[model samples]
Target: MWNRLFNKKSSVQRKILVSFLGLIIFPLGLFSYASMSVSKETIRKKEISSSLKTLELIADKLNIMASDLTAISNLYFANSSLYDLLKPPQGLGIYEENAKKDFLIKTMINYKYAYTWMDYNTTLFGKNGFELHTYYEGRKIGLDSIKNEPWYAEVVKANSGIVWVSDPSPKLIPTVDDDHFVSAVRILKDFESGTMLGIFLISVSESFLYKQYGNAVQDYEQVLLIDDKGIVISAPDKKMIGQAISSFGERTNKLADESGHFTTKVNKRNMLITYDSVGKTGWKIIAYTPLKELYADIGKIERLTILLFLSVLAISILVSYFIARRLSIPIQRLFTSMKKVEMGNLSERSDVTGEDEIGELARKFNRMVSRIEDLRDRVSAEQEMKRKTEFRALQSQINTHFLYNTLASIRSMLMIDPPEKVDAIIVALVRLLKKTLTEKGEFIPIAEEMDNLRNYIRIQEARQHEHLRVVFEVDEQIMHLKTLKLLLQPIVENAIFHGIEPKPTPGTVLIQGELSDNKVWFRIRDDGVGYSGFPPSDTELDITELVLEQSAGMGLRNIRDRIRLHYGAGGELSVISRSEGGTDVVLSIPAIMDPEELKL
Candidate 1:
């Protein structure tokens, strides 16, 4: 089945449609499943983290409330006036005793109003019985009525400082009903003797706990407050309060961590459980949420992903058919054209046209056929031209030998006459001809080229007799560097014939050479009639066209072309008709120490 599906006999459209469906559907389905799994886990973790944060916030508020109650109790114990009232003179009269009681009652009332968390304030004097101050008024209770209370005994037994106790049973007090309270209890001592004088108690209602954590209860199915002894101190179901946490499920031991979250099953329902401690109260706030309820959105996403995959599979079939047709038609046309060209048909061409890669291939194929036809037509003509050029070059070599032999004969004749001035001229001419005719190489040292230029200048000066002045400013370091032969002499000859000869006064030709940035530079400036018999123009003038237009243009053109051919783009020649009554020809070429280093 797989071989039949992928066989070459299948149409392009069918193959593309099958391939596209396989590529798109398989990965999309796999990715959707993976994404759904990751998203489900992410939602579970985020919900647990959010519940833990809420639980921690409620625990912090509870701790702040406890700390506030403890601070108020400390303030009362530090009050000297309260201490004086509690320890009255032994023989005080009724009026004075009554006055002290009134002062003490006023102080206690003020404290109850000052600290909102403190619901009831009470003091138990060792001898004077207990005084209770609620929001409304003061009352006196006999020592026997409250001394036997469970928290009272606990506070007395742990006698060094303040002790916190959550009343297991709600005690009825005036101005507050049926609500249990968490109390801060401390012992008061006489300032002078450091002896225990009384017991201090500040109690806050348990309804404060519900108010602080009420928002969190709405977010979860059940919220429980459990103590370290595995006892449920508070619960959403009021009847469950004061019961052991094990009664709910098997989660009592996991509350040892200060703050954490976990997943557990209780009564056949999976639940996410989060808990945090409430200060040092040995009590923890635990929130429980059912997993099914928490992940309701994930179910919807799974269904939507299935629907999307089906829609994408249908769209891919239609798109892949048209795309495959568009690509395959051009390729088929290109293959036909290639076969025609293979059968010796050079004019065959592909009509494919677009900006895509297939279009570019067809265009290149057409250009290749045209280029081959052009080469076939030009082959015979190039052969004929090559034969003529070689014949002329051979004849030119023979003429060079004949000229050298003629100059040697003249030198022998001049030695016989022995005229001093004529001998110098003949010697200079022979040196110039030998440098030009001998095929040592195309490149020579700058010093040797300069020597040839000086020899030509000597012959010209001897003939013209003070009509021309030449100046050489060559850097010693660059004299050994190699440059093209005959590069400077032609320009010097053009300057003498066209520039210096035309001027009525004697003209100076300055030849300057320098080395810079791995290139050799030459500047030939003549103080003669400049371009068009005026000072040179500043605009760029094409040296090739300008040289061709002159009477001696061939020499200048030959020099420029030779330099360009040898150095390619690295060689440059420019003619700058100077503004100061002269013409300057600047030439630049790559600096080389030997002829073999020349690229050409």
Candidate 2:
């Protein structure tokens, strides 16, 4: 059933419609759906991963800040002046004691200058009952007040090392107005005696943490920093700080992993939360986005997909319809014309106006039939011309009787006187007659043709008592080249008879031959009565009629016809009157050398 519907005999319009819908539209629709689904999922996953990476980077910055504070605290504890101030006085004067206090104060001030993050630093000497603080004029702090502080006690209990204390509310140094600080405290010990010297505290502002990590949270709908105890240490909302993590919902529990994302409810709104842990600090950075906002573009993409599919479907249908008609109409016309041509109607033609392969085929077919018709007419014309030429040749044979009459005259002269001049004349006439009668071939060597020309000129000069002066200017290089026989004799004859015979004085006839480019040329010029009827050099003349009528030379006309027949268009003959009251005939033909003649 499918084959019947899709067979080649089916209408092209139906075939095109079915093919476009099945092969193009179907696959395009399937691919668009699959790509939309994959693109949505890929974009969502990539966005989640990018948010997690940003959180991890913020965590790294926090870890670095903690390490910096720890290093600064350790440096301050190892100062020798702190140990000296803690040691027993050893009978020193109050002046020296004050000097040492001044040195310790200068050292702490230098620490504050070097570490910009350090908001305030203080030291308590247990033995000397003196306290030093970075703020305040006296640089003194009451030891009793901090001695009972939990962080202070924790540092002393540790005794031999540093302790980090996350203080929600730190007591401000006497004149320092900051109430929130993250403190690193360490117990100072005498290096030689292992005696407890003092307690050192370095407090960093909590605002510095927010300032460093704030940009990471800017892109999220909401962000929070939660400690291991599930307390919100920092948030975009300052009031949210110090609140229980449960206020944000159970999503905080999922943040126990190093980094992750999950869909959950936050304040009764759908949210996607991504979180990353902040190293060993027991803190995690969390970012959240509302689901509706995150996938807002997906809805637009779905709408666009449907619109694009419909646009493509409509365009494909139109294109398919036009393309089917464009191709089928020309083909149908060609097939119809071919049927006509098959029935022996060669005049039938297909429309070849379109610019396509089918149009080209139609043009080629028309050209083929035109060429066949041309060949048939040309063959018929050639047969008719051949018959006419044979008839002319037969009529031209009547001139041979003149040769017989000349032979008879030569016989009579031989009987009357056997003079050397007469014998030479008879010998020249015999050679000319032998060549004209015996040689039936159309082509001969240029050297042989020149010999014949010399013989004919000799006989003519003898008859005219040497009144005609014959000059030969032949290039030996082209003497062996073959050309149409009797080509030059006729031109030479016209030069002597019509050109020189009418002149009162002795006239010189020049026969010159040369090879140039790929052609052999001969020019016969005579100082005789110039023929004014000669055509211009560039004009194409039918030499048969031109020579026979105006030049009154049958030999010239016959030579022209033979040259044209043998060499086609390449052979040419032209006659023009020379400015010096003479005539010049130029003959040109392709140079074909005989190999056997070359050896001779």
Candidate 3:
């Protein structure tokens, strides 16, 4: 056996030690690389997050500046003095081109910008849209001529009380007359008459946001001032000052006010980016870091892990070479014994004699296989016996139930009825017997079952004339749906026999079928002697008598048991009735099955 084991080991192309070593070594190298890469990713995300915080601070300040600008614009547009002056000649407006006594100092205080002014014109279509009237600090120091400015016509053309932010325009400076002052302009007016013949312009420095947030962060990170349209209203970079951020704007349109971080390829390099938005203006702040730079230390760790993994692989191969040989003999015996059992030689046993754990494990395994064989035989016999028991129970309930009752009814009809009545009675009895015995098959179409039920009810009516009125209201669509044989008749018979027969006055026996919620439900109800107040679960009710005593309730117990057996516990025939009125026996069953499955 030792010589054979040596020969087997030599014939193998890949030694077990080498196979084991590669398994341990390869995953270690891969995991080490993956761990370092994940660490790098985490670091990159942290940096981007930190930068995003700084961007948020800048974004908040910029949004506040824009809101404050809007507030001031609204205040100017709502000014009543200016609003009354722009009204039609109702005696409330100023008629001069210069500032009046009441407007002189107040307008100066409100319009604090260097070249701020309120200009007026005789007509909206005048050659100059507006003539400078109330100028702050004089046009000599920092003044602007609105007559020829591109914004002058635009501002005057718009109706008063509306703010408009125009494109960049030129304004005249004090010392340098040609040095244009950049400004945001709007129109001021009266509320009574929507007339506009003047302009309200605020001259602001071009480097408004850049001078404030330009040096707030490092060169690696960016700070942007975005407007409602995601346009770069102001920024440190001259090129990006008025440019739009379409990508960010598009994302904002998709995700409203929610904020998060993401890793995506930007300019062909992987970058970690995080951003947030000012809810009202749709302005955003974005911070980014290069993934490779953030994860550089992780890459170093990955290289060290790979080197360590390779060394471990070598040491493992040296150790496992002798270890694998030591255990190979024991494992070979398991393979041999398992093959014999798989080939139906259940008597075969593993005989790897030893004092260690493997020897004990082999002994237990042999014992377990022996018990498994014994269990197989026992379970087979038990299942066969269970199947027979179920069929016998169903047969007992179906066969002996209505047969003897039909015979007794026939004997009574023969004694009292005439010849013609006897012939009709025999024909109906034959049809009822065919249905009860189910000579056609165990399973019948629902339409056939209804025909059988009509015959049965007719014969019963012959016996108990006007004592019971059986009314059937079956849904037409459910006529072709299949169900178990005689699933409902037993219950209906019980309701009439137990519930309605004892009542003094003739009572209604109502049988209805309908397709509701993909299932067939038949309600056998009777407005008759009603129900017993006794509960089925109560111990005093003699459940054995109700179940097996062949009393009026015996058929109902049989019906319920058959339903549970066929439907595997989900199907049921539950009885619900109201006292002194009617009893309703509900028979619920599945309605559809393929023809092949129906055979089963």
Candidate 4:
């Protein structure tokens, strides 16, 4: 059922389907990954914190043990019997070597301490050097090396206070890797001054440390011991107990604090190592938890989370199929209407049936299409009107293209005749063509338009021996004002064809323009028969304004139309005439024409 509703039958609907599916799949997958990562990290942190705490507790016990050893050493150093023996025994203090050894061994056995120390009573050392005693248990005094042994020299140097190491050592005791060990040494003190007189030593087995730690395993995760030099004195890795550790790149000493966790490699195993040091001894207790084990349980939780996420996503996909199909029904209808609009049917529109955002978009889309169709119709009508105007203008257009061909034909006519009249026609045509076709622009300076009038005079001279004469007039700015192409040419043509051509004698024709009151006034005047083969004036042009205006429009109608299209109605025209004498016409057009509007 789901597959049939949201199939690949249409790509647009399929995109909607895929969008809904992503809403389920991607977020669930991301949440699963995040939850798993947090779970794994939390577990690792708990393990490391627990291990550091265990190490701190072990260090606390070591502090107590070291204190007790100090107290014992202090007490023995102040003992009067041992202190008096530091000088001369006086009587009982003097003794034989073998006998002295046997007596001290008995004292040790009674005390049951690991070992005891004593220096020779010099006054009592009558015949031999200083005597030494190495005693254990109650009376087991064995061979002594007072002169060469390191422990014997250390006690004498310490002279008074206690010195004990809370560390693991394999030197004198038999024990497994986990067994803990320590030692103590001190100097005998004078009974009166409490000054050191001799030295004593003791070595305790790991049994004392074992009892201290009894069930420390569960209380804390790990425990270790570090000495004054930052060496690992007590640790699970037995080999590292004696070997020193250097910082990777530090120039100075690197020591663990009171308690904290750090990474270190021991026995080629990278571990989370936590340690705390015994205050006075400088020895530390260290514990390590393998990061791999801590992460192991967390990994299982992560896998389960991912599985749950996949199951949820699978169910969500099933639900989304229906939701996507329901949502896409309206969008499918919108696309159908849009296709109809694309195929030359602008009247087609979407039927929006809801007030949701998507429905609003469809309604707006339909309105936009309606507006576009309206604009297209308006543009089509405007183009049709413009085509008629251009065609009519082109029918009467005799300017640049017309003159070029006429002059080229006239040049050929000159070659065949070789007469003065032909030569004059050739010269007149050359001047005429230049004046009409300007290199600068379609709108030329009045000076250039006047140049065309001179050519017209020359052509008439050759054709009818100067039947008419002309004059020009203008202002400085008006001379440069842009006017339409061949504006004067047609005015001159009308005067010659209707006015001067029928005259019995020569006549006057004038062409000129002037700037006045921010506008330009152009005039063409002639003394001739006016209209319809009559005298100088006629009723066919009875309204001077009508003849001048219409002729101005016909002569400059395109120009006025182009100007009105470009500028406005303020562009005007006028005409004046008498039946026999002449006619005058003027164009009141914009003088300050925009150069951009004047571009060809």
Per-residue CA lDDT of candidate 2, range 1-600, in tens?
Answer: 778768988876568667766787879989998988897788779879888888888888878876777777767777777777777777346788789889888877787788775455554545557566666566445555567775666677888566765552344433344444455677778888887777766666556667767776535367777776777767667777777888767645587788899888888988888888877466777788787777778778878888999999889878887877776787778878888878767788887577878889999989987877688679869976894575358325424533654565566666664588688987888787677666366567888888888887776766666577899999999988898666777677678768898889989999899999889889998988755465344433334345567636656666776776666687888876655477778889888875233223
Candidate 1: regions farther than 4 A off: 1-26, 80-93, 117-127, 136-153, 172-175, 189-198, 216-218, 309-600
The segments of candidate 4 whose C-alpha lies over 4 angstroms from its true place after superposition are 1-49, 79-110, 113-156, 165-181, 189-198, 206-223, 247-256, 263-271, 340-600
Candidate lDDT (C-alpha), each: 0.73, 0.72, 0.61, 0.58
Q: Could you estimate the TM-score for every candidate?
A: 0.45, 0.43, 0.38, 0.45
Q: What is the alpha-carbon RMSD of candidate 1 to the true structure?
A: 21.1
**lDDT at position 441, candidate 3:** 45
The backbone clash count of each candidate, in order, is 1, 0, 4, 18
The candidate maximizing TM-score is: 4
RMSD of each: 21.1, 19.1, 29.4, 16.4
Looking at model 1, residue 156 earns an lDDT score of 66
- List runs of model 2 lying over 4 Å from the truth: 1-36, 86-93, 116-129, 136-143, 146-154, 168-170, 173-176, 191-197, 251-253, 299-303, 306-600
Best by lDDT: 1
Candidate 3 residue pairs that clash: 83-189, 83-190, 141-174, 171-181
Backbone clashes in model 2, listed as residue pairs: none
Tens-place lDDT per residue, model 3, 1-600, is 435444555533235655676677778768876877687768766776677776677667656655555555565566555544444444443455235425633554555452233221111111223323233244321213445665466556655423323233333433112222234456654454544445555444436546546777666655555555566655556566556666543354532454567777767887666666754345566555566766667778777776787688778877777677677767677768888888866778898878888788788879977987788779868965774586566656655666666667777888887778767877997877666664454556788788877887777787777788988899989888777677777777777777777889888888899987777888888876655544333122223333334455667767676666566544656566554456677778777643235224
Residue 74 in candidate 2, Cα distance off native in Å = 0.9
Give candidate 1's whole-model lDDT.
0.73
